[model samples]
Target: MSGDPADEQLVRQAQGGSRAAFDMLVLKYQRRVERLLSRSVRDPADVADLCQETFLAAYRALPGFRGESAFYTWLYRIAVNIAKRHRARQRPLESLEDGEGTFGTDAAPSDDATPEALLANRQLVRGLDEAVQALAEDQRRALLLREVDGLSYDEIADLMDCPPGTVRSRIFRARESLSARLRPLLEGRGGRRW
Candidate 1:
């Protein structure tokens, strides 16, 4: 068993059909799954239901879960997929006419959003953009390429003419700088740490 008994060992036991082990996994990750779902699900009741569905789906698929990826990574992917499906079922609000022409939905907004909430969101986005802009050129490019462009670290390294390790370091540093700048704005907001 791994030194962290609650992780690998519980997964192994759960795979062997131990209900208690499976229940333990659910208990450990319930809060995290709910928090993740809350990002795309506005209703508290809906978030709770989705969390249950996610765990149920994970349980059914447990037999096929190879040990290739960490258990949490596998579970996280399942939760995100469930949340995406839940969001897709919600009706979209009116389409924007800004040439971009994208549809909006209540799923993307908090259920209790007021004018103040909208302003706070806009301010947060502006603050993040400013933080990104304040980064060094190389760091900014590396971060954006990885995040906004969704490029692999190796791909980013090739484009930036740097080693993959260097790209990773640059991205980490950039995130640290941005996090430092945004910490105060996010403090006491009950947001996820990462």
Candidate 2:
């Protein structure tokens, strides 16, 4: 009903056990929370559970919020920790898929093409995927958050607990690495190009 209601007021109301206030907060943060989790989570479906857990934790700690940092910062920290922990817990069974066998002999994902174009596309994706995989973890995370999850640099910084400058640097490095890695594909030198 007003021009941009304040988040602090909403938070205070939520903290006081106002379900409507909490719902508003949830609606405001839902997309961001999902994006933050999706940046690292392989299975997007699993993001729902993680988002809930993050919010649950936030709700529990809401009263303790000192406002030392913005609410989104605090929420971002919770989301990142939850995502990182979830990633860590699944790490033993999960790997970056090293070696030729994991990616197949082609070194890429299947192409969206047919017949003559099919093999070429697959090689393209493979080369691109490998290039992305080769990036350093921090760079890869930033790049993935942007390219895959479609998050803004500010959102990425929040999720990574870093400054926007750092996020930009990582993404730049990642794009460079990926471009170099995929260069062969672009030139049709790696496998096939037309």
Clashes of 2: 2
What ranges in model 1 sit over 4 Å off? 1-5, 93-194
Q: In TM-score terms, which candidate is top?
A: 2
Please, what are the lDDT tens digits per residue for candidate 1 over residues 1-194?
Answer: 31244678888899998999999999988987776566456567998999999999999999998766556667767887897788789885322222111112223677788988777766666567667657896897688767755778976775566799999999999999988998877884665444
Write out the backbone clash pairs for model 1.
none
lDDT of 2 by residue, 24-130 (tens): 88899899889767646656578999999999999999989876666777887899889889987885433334323113345343555456676665566567666
lDDT, candidate 1, at 114: 94
**lDDT, candidate 1, residue 163?**
92
Candidate 2 vs. true structure, TM-score:
0.69
lDDT values for all models: 0.74, 0.74
